[model samples]
Target: MMKIRDVGHAIWDRPLGRIVLLLVGGLVIAVTVMLYPPLRDVVQWFLPLGLIIWGGSRVYLYGRNDLLSLISGCLLILGGITRAVFQLIPLNELAGTVANLIPVVAIFSEMFAHHYREQE
Candidate 1:
């Protein structure tokens, strides 16, 4: 006999649930971007909060070996440190955007790695 997984409590056990959550998060970000003025001023306010929540959840779910979570945590740390320094240094905003994207690319790269690892 095969075992069945419980749905109500095992939300993270399935990938679809995760996809839905990601989509919802993206929607929230999109809405915030479209509807809000003073977004740059607010981004630092919300991003750190979001980063903490995201990193904590990922650590809880996947432990330290979760590449995505690890990358995110590193990215948050780097961004925070850079932002603090740049406030005093006044580096190019475009450069900051590009620097921040390193983590985004790392995330996608790791996602692809996970996908291929699963296929093996």
Candidate 2:
């Protein structure tokens, strides 16, 4: 008795729509993953990239009077290098990644450094 479009609008415009969308996205990814093999080297890039991003975040705290952050950041950087070595990332590509992250690092650093300072 109800039109399909009316039903879609009722269900898809509510807060529950977000959860339904996530489930649908996951199902699509699962089907696609079965069809296409993941690239190992591409997957390996995430290790160093994530480390660099996280370490850069801690390193930024140095600007806000946290020396411990510098220490932790240095440790994380070392860990990233170790991960890159283990993951077989080429030096050239690693350098390129670091270069690419320069602006991203600055933005994240600034954002997080003052995030707590702003009051709601």
Please name the candidate that would achieve the greatest TM-score relative to the true structure. 2
Give candidate 2's error at residue 34 in angstroms.
5.1
Predicted structure 2, TM vs. truth: 0.42
Instruction: Estimate the TM-score of every prediction.
Output: 0.39, 0.42
Clashes of each: 0, 0
CA lDDT for candidate 1:
0.59
lDDT of 1 at 51: 46
Best by lDDT: 2
Clashing pairs in 1: none
What is candidate 2's local distance difference test score?
A: 0.63
Q: Model 1 — which ten-residue stretch has the worst lDDT?
A: 1-10
